[model samples]
Target: MGDSRPVYQRIADDLRQQIDEGVLAVGSRIPSRSELKRTYAASDQTVDRAVRVLKAAGYAEGQFGRGVFVTDRSPVGSLLRTGEAVDSPFAARLLAGSSAAPPLLWEATSTATGAPPRIAERLGIGAGDRVMCTRYEYLADRRPLQLATSWEPLALTEGTEVVFPERGPYARRGVRERFAAIGLPVVKATELVGSRSATSTESQALGCSPGQCVTVIERTHHTADGQVVETSDIVLRADRWRLEYHIAFPG
Candidate 1:
């Protein structure tokens, strides 16, 4: 007896095998719907459904008015857990197999708003307290790979040049440097990691299906005296990235 899988699933599985085995190269055009139909003796609906599955699985993407093409299928930079700070951006230099200049790019915007209950609690502030919120998207070779939002209590940065994260000289500077400039030195940090299904908006922003999962990293930065200076929520496509760690052996 032949395989019992549905026609669409069988087609998707075979295409995935070709992608995995290098028969389909990254960024290369996949066979057109008509071609696949002819090759598999399937209907238009079957081929269309198979292509959707490939897109959802990050194996391929359809270009409007053009055709579907294989995606990079490579993992973005790994997140390194280390002792120096809470979380360091694992970027360009750490990208595997990427020899291009500036392997990653950043698009970010900052807004001043009242903190929500959850964010306020994370930053040790009361709900509705004033805070500076900055949202960012990290792109690898112009493709969005990660999203993050950082929140800081306005009380700590008020009257300082660092109040507006993207407007001052301290803009885009690391947390420690920004804090040091404001007389609040970041001495310790903590992080928690989890995963959940992507929301509709998140999936749209990430070009993934809503059913896909995302990895979330919650990071908090603290001053030496235990003041919460900053807290951030980082989200990444679960299938496109991996977490890494570097630590020294105990003395």
Candidate 2:
């Protein structure tokens, strides 16, 4: 019984298994190209391909001029989907379980831009409608933790005090309260989560190699009458955080 797989597949499988078993612990460098070739009795091309496979699948990442290393996928923290964090999501992201946590900080930029088609649909508006689009970056202990881009229809906030998400008195007040200021209280929200490869921009800001795995959450807030007030796309390094959703029993 032999593993008739190609050299690259075999190499990748072996290293992946090691990572799964913690033999190749996080932050530790994997065998170099020369070493892998020697051990597998394979050519340089085969070894290189194997390494590429590892990097592509998010099991490892390479530092500039440094060899490939196992990625740190340990649970750095948890993303709590409740309370004020939901109100001011633009401010902080990781609300991990009780423990002395790193100080959280964030930055955001908002602009009057045309809504992309997807966002337009989420807001129940026509494509190219003007919307106040905002981008956010969250950091903990000075390290990038997450990224988000939010879109709010200008038609809903044009003459209000909360037009800009990061400006004015109502800034960072979360959707419910901010909209409530204008007599448009948000009653509920919906979220959809999925996985994808990190884009070049995401990888750089999150401090991970390009093509690494990342999680994306599409969220929308609505009024009691089902009016869409805000929508956003949230992105974070998949290996670095655990997302928690608490459900209450209808007792």
Candidate 3:
């Protein structure tokens, strides 16, 4: 029973349950520390500890002066699944900081995982091979925007810690810059776009309503030599993002 757990653990568990039950949907503000202390009849330390636990577990996040709030629960794939490839040009233009695009915030993380079957096939490697994975979550004006994960062969990344770099490549030389340093320069990319419903875990991350649709963008990058060096899958929130593409015609 929750009662047997530590008071802080119990409080965290209760909050987690609330989130799972939709009592605290995405963007919902949580009680202040003092309020939580009073409600739980616990000390400030206990309440603070509970909040920290929740945050560490990715259930909640703190906003300066605004207190804590529930995280978005939308899945990352909702934004790219529309059978619409027409927006690729527009998205590319936006990535290029073209005149018509708005500014955005992008965060990236690199990880190492035992290659899953799907990823292995994409990289022409065996399943369970060690692989370096880079995840990117892009936001526009602090809203849930787009999600992407890129995978590379671990052998190719030896001597370079692409994943968990001290300062993310995006923060330094940018994604292209970092890859270039490792001799994996990207020359061209092919994409496949589709849609699907959000998984429970993805729904929690994207802060979307249950059963909401999502977009998925799968991309494979090739070097100038035509070697498939990296593969990325990007998921996005459908409502929060728009896809735009440019059409070119020649006489």
Candidate 4:
């Protein structure tokens, strides 16, 4: 823990490190506020404040009946190619002046409550299943670029209790890499694209106005057996981040 920060901040940072280090596995439940208070020897309000810090930093979320759970996904380091060939017709038009590097603002846990009903069904889990989620705000040359969110099924990550397990569901190596390590290699992915006005939270995260339009990319990942393993949503500031797709002509 860094000495320059406050005790609560240090506490939060330690928890974050544990998550990043796989001490806390994705989708695993965290100790209750009272438990934290007892462990940290702090007041209830202090523990609550620390938890809120974790949430804002994208480490955990509070589920009504299930308690707080760690999110599984992490931020994407590159935007150019996600191990998939670009072949969409609008590929050229989307890539004009789009750069690969984007500054990161925040990457922490996000609640899965806002997902559309259809997406919930596709995961083969009820709307109530604890999901490990991550959110990132991308910036180019210090300006807002894009915002993205990714989610993974908790059931797939059972037994991994670290906030960000080193070898569980969606670790630093990504879902594909983690799955492969566990003998569940991903073979393909299907993506859906669209656009919409920025929600209040999106606006705050992306540093954009509420009415500004944003690009939305929803992807469903599958394994060799065609089992849908995970789903992700990438939202970008329409004016800043542009999508580039490389197409192969079938002559």
The best candidate by TM-score is 2
Error of 1 at 240 (Å): 4.3
State the lDDT of candidate 4 residue by residue for 10-38, as single tens digits: 67887888888999898888788788878
Q: Which of the numbered candidates is closest to the native, going by highest lDDT?
A: 2
lDDT of each: 0.82, 0.85, 0.66, 0.62
Using all chains and alpha carbons, the TM-scores for the candidates as numbered come to 0.78, 0.91, 0.54, 0.53
**Order of quality (lDDT):** 2, 1, 3, 4
Q: Which portions of model 3 show Cα errors greater than 4 Å? A: 1-103, 161-175, 249-251
Error of 3 at 43 (Å): 46
Predicted candidate 3 versus true structure: per-residue lDDT over 109-194, tens digit per residue: 76788889998888788999988787776665565466777787777765674544325443334345556777678676677778
Candidate 2: RMSD over Cα atoms? 2.5
Candidate 2 off by > 4 Å: 83-85, 90-101
Q: Higher lDDT: candidate 2 or 4?
A: 2
Residue-level lDDT of model 1, residues 41-124, one tens digit each, is: 999999999988888777887788989999875765576667653445533234646522255678878888999999999998
Model 1 residue runs over 4 Å out of place are 1-6, 35-43, 85-92, 96-100, 103-107, 139-145, 195-214, 224-226, 237-240
The 10-residue segment with the lowest total lDDT in model 3: 74-83
lDDT of 1 at 3: 95
